[model samples]
Target: MLRIGLVGIGFMGRVHMLSFTDKPMIPNAYVKNGKLVAVCDIDSKKLEQAKKEIPSLEIFSDYKEMLASGKVDAVIIATPHYLHPLMGIEALKNKIPVLIEKPVGVFTKNVFELNEVASQNPDVVFGLLFNQRTNPFFVKAKEIIDNDGIGKLKRMNWMITNWYRPQKYYDNGSWRGTWAGEGGGVLMNQAPHQIDLWQWLCGMPTKVRAYCKFGKNRNVEVETDVTAYVEYPDGGSGVFVTSTHDAPGTNRLELIGNNGKIVIENEILSYKKLLVPENKLNETATANLMDPKNAPQFEEVIYTKKELGDIPWGVEHAITIENWINTIEGKEELIAPGIEGVKALELINSMLLSTFLDKEIELPIDSNKYYEELMKKCEKSEFKDTWRV
Candidate 1:
């Protein structure tokens, strides 16, 4: 049986714990042979509270101590964004299978370092907590795109603002919205899923020009609102707008291509398949200005239970975790490997860099320059923290 220890007992950490222990009761909590053996956190009170809930649960204050103790066969790193790569590297170096929580790291350089270590330990199981990869709607979108369902993408737009965080939410934790602690705002924390899904379904854009508003709605040091314009290599363009202030916000993705257009929002996918490809129409039509003679056909896709709107959050997480455990046992492949995480991080870094330079930034951003700029913000941050333990 795989003995799993979870590092960090914060919000996400607790969610992981619930997925492990509350078996039949928890959504998507199905693994052949694994047990929740230990948990680690810096706060002793939190550890004590955890022990009270699970009397047999082993607790440690330091992750290093827990790793060296040999009580766990695998470790789940659910700590802060900055600590993800660092903690994951330590687990990999210890020859322990690791499943790290998302965004990989705050920056690409750190993730590269962790990836280097992961490369050397090729046999060790390394999975990322990109649970949204399990969503059915996204899965169908990827399948359609890969199969040329949209045929030569021309435009993409995603307006995701469901991330509504009030000032009290940020004030509740020391590391909530600071540059030093959580990295960026909506892009880093709330929108990583959408960003990852964006690239997963539509492919990464070559250039990004972003306008980010820091603390525009909340009293935080990082950006709470952002709108970015991206250009693709195939003459495709995209607009991504996200914020944490908009209540009754929208989560919509629209992808237009030569063959048709796809719209996904609020648990529904509306696909518009043109009878004649837009490119074909443009080439064959003789009229000075004209629409396609044959009207476009539209259909609402009925998602299987596995699709986006159907899967519960806890179930999706459990499904990803099960894939990780099965991968470690050589019974199955990982749903989301640790390496693919770099794409999202690259996008995040590029957006921030574009915002800082007030110009369009290209893909594969200058990691060193971004790191230098990020450190400058961290150095000048005026956020007061009386909540760290």
Candidate 2:
């Protein structure tokens, strides 16, 4: 069996630990070939609690000690945002496979450096916990796009604001909503999955112009609301809007292409396929501007939650963990490679940088410039008791 060591026995750490057991909290989904052999954390109380939960499990106060003890074949990092790349680098240097939680690092520079180390250790199974990738609807959307069901993307819009967090949620942890602690607000915390899926399905934008509201109706120092306009390489454009304060919030994604349009909202996928490509109609149409003959012919198909059987809540998290363990055992490939984590980081960093500089930021952003800006915020940040690796 694959021996898995988990770092940072916090909320997400506990969630990952659940998946390693035969009887996971999420029924019918567990890592069959792996077990949580060791756990490391700074909190003695959490370590004691973990020991109580798994009496046979080894516990450590220092992660480096755990990595050096040779008790675990792999490590899963569930630490804070800033420590992700640092711990990942340490694990890679120790030649241990690692699965990291999302938004790989606070900024692109650190993530790029982590990717560099990951590239050097090509044989290591480095993965990221982007659990939303396991959703059947998203997988099906990817299939349709890859098969040219939606030809030549023209526009994309995703307004995902369903991740509503109350003030008490932020107040629960010292490192919850501060810039020095958790990095950005909704983009870094709540919307990284959607941003990943956005770029995963529609591709990255070449330029981004964003407007953000920092501490908007929230007692935090980071952005709570954001609206960004992006331009693609093919002259295509897109918009992304997200927030953590919108109640009765919306989760919608619309993709318009040359041959069809796809709308995913309310756990349903609505696809409209045109009989003739829009460009073809534009070029060959002989009818008058308002003629009925010029009307477009199309077919619509709707896919609902009923199409996909009962998926227990939070099961995808276990599924992602299983995929990582399988990849380590050479049974399958990684679904969310650690290197791809940088794309979403770059996109979010660009959005914040755009809001910071009040201008449109281009792709392949100046990482040094962004780092400098982030450091300025860090220097002024009030949350100084942030976790360190």
Candidate 3:
């Protein structure tokens, strides 16, 4: 069996642990050749609680000790945002297979360093817990886009505000909304999945100009609301907007191309396929007074993928874990490789950098300069309860 170790016993760690159990949420998933052999957390009380829930489970207060004891064949780093890269690099250097949690890291420089260590250990498997990649709707979207179904993208817009968090949520954790701790607000936590999906489906933009509001409605130092405009190299453009304060929030993505359009919202994927490509009609139109307004009508198809379950987060995460196990056994390929984690991080940093400098930021950003800017913010960080535990 693939003896797996899980680091971090907080919210995500608990969610990861449940996927390994006989929970009904993941009825279709199980690690056939692997099991959770050990768990590590800095919080002793959390470790104690974990032992109560998992009687036969091994526990560790220090991750390094667990790594050195050779108790686990692989590990899942589910710690906070800042710990992903640090713990990932340590696990990779030890020649241990690792599946790191999202955004890879708060910044590109650190994630790049972790990736360098992973590259050095080619045999060791590396994956990221970008579980949303397993969602059928997103999978279908990627297939359609890759097949040129949308043909020469012109514009894309995604306004995802379903991530609503109250002041109490941030008040409970001192590190929740600070630059020195969580790195960012909505972009880092609530929107990593959307950000990753954005690049995964639409590709990274060439430049980004963003406006962000810090502590807009919440009592936090990082951005709680953001609106960003992006440009692609092929002249295509996009608009992204998100907020944690909008109730009855919206989660919609619309993609327009020369041939057709796609709109995904409320777990449904709809497409409008053009009979004659727009560009072709634009060039060969016979009428001088009017544009080509006639095109074959297409029906809207709803894609529920009921087999994937109604609650996507838990189900998709379970699928990701199963895929990771099979990949380690040479049975399948990873849907979300850890290295691709940098793409979303770059997008996050770019948007935030644009907000900080009040101008458009270019892609493949200057990592050192961003890091320098971040450290300056870190120095002046004024979060009162900055996570002493």
Candidate 4:
């Protein structure tokens, strides 16, 4: 059985703990080689409190102690956004795998650097908690998109704003808002999932044009609203609008193809699929597209939509964790591995860069240069992550 430790005792750390318990629940706790062996935090009171709940576990004020103790096989990092890269890099350097919370780093350069570090330590498995990728709805969306639900993808409209955060939510921590601290607002923190989905389902656009407003409707340092137009090759395109200030919020994704359009709202995937020709003999390309002998055919493919509505937070954590566990046991593949997450990170970073620079930025962004640029305007920040209840 692989023993594991968790660092950070904030809201996300607790969520990580809860997700570990949700696995099977056969023994009402983590098992199958995965156990919460140790925990660490600077706050003695908080660490002590956590120890009581997790009896038989060890606690430490310094994360280095936990690593040096060598009592576990892996670590889960649920610390603040800025600390992700540092902690993650430290753990990998120690030869311990890590399952870090979202937005891997404050900037994409950090993510790429982290990836390089992980590559140096192939014995360790670095992962991101991109739990949403495991959700049935999204998994199905990817499958359909890969199979071509829409003919020659034409347009996409994504209107997602159900992630409204109150000022108190930001005010709870002095470091919440500020270009230097939390690293941009909604897009970096709350919207990584949507951003990941945008990239996952539609892939990164060759070019992006955007307009963003920082604290226009709220008192946060980073942008609260954004509208962007993304241009892709294959004559396909998309328009994206995201915010954390909309009232009676909504999460909707609309994809239009030459044949049909698909809408995913209310967590339900409703579609008007265009048909494709049946009985085509081509193996690789649609027989009609590849050969004149096989003219383009038209037949609609229906997806048996799963019953999904109002998904709970961290719903897919268990799936991600279980996959990691299985991978360690040589039973399956890693879920949301670190390298793939870098792609998601770049997409988000570019969106922010485009909005900030008022110009399009290409994919696989230069994180080091971007970080340098970010520092020029951001000078410094104040969010040290108090881990508000």
What are the candidates' C-alpha RMSDs? 2.8, 1.7, 2.6, 6.0
Ranking by lDDT: 2, 1, 3, 4
Q: Per-residue lDDT for 258-326 in model 4, tens only?
A: 755677776577666634523333445654465754554444434444344333445566667767777
* Alpha-carbon runs more than 4 Å astray in model 3: 23-32, 282-300, 306-311, 383-389
Query: Top model by TM-score, which number?
Result: 2
In order of listing, the candidates' clash counts read 3, 0, 0, 12
Q: Which 10 consecutive residues of model 3 have the lowest summed lDDT?
A: 290-299
What are the per-residue Cα lDDT tens digits for candidate 2 across 71-171?
Answer: 99999999888999999999999999999998799999888899999999999989999999888788878888998998999999999888899999999
lDDT for model 4, on a 0 to 1 scale? 0.74
Q: Of the pair 1 and 2, which is ahead by lDDT?
A: 2
Order the candidates by TM-score, highest first. 2, 3, 1, 4
| Least well predicted 10-residue stretch by lDDT in candidate 1 | 380-389
The digit string of per-residue lDDT tens for model 3 on 210-259 reads 99898999989899999999999999999999999999899999998888
lDDT (tens digit, per residue) of candidate 1 on 1-389: 88999999888788788676654446665544678899999989999988988788999999999999989999999988888888899999999999999888998988999999999999999999899989888887887888888889999999999899988999897788998878889999999988988888888889999999999979999999999999999899999999999998999999998887788887877776766666556443445345534344444454444444477766788888888998999999998899889899999999999988899998879998998888888776665442211
Q: What are the lDDT figures for the candidates, one per model? A: 0.85, 0.89, 0.85, 0.74
Once model 3 is optimally superposed onto the true structure by TM-score, how far is the C-alpha of residue 355 displaced, in angstroms?
A: 0.7
lDDT for residue 284 in candidate 3, whole number 0-100: 36
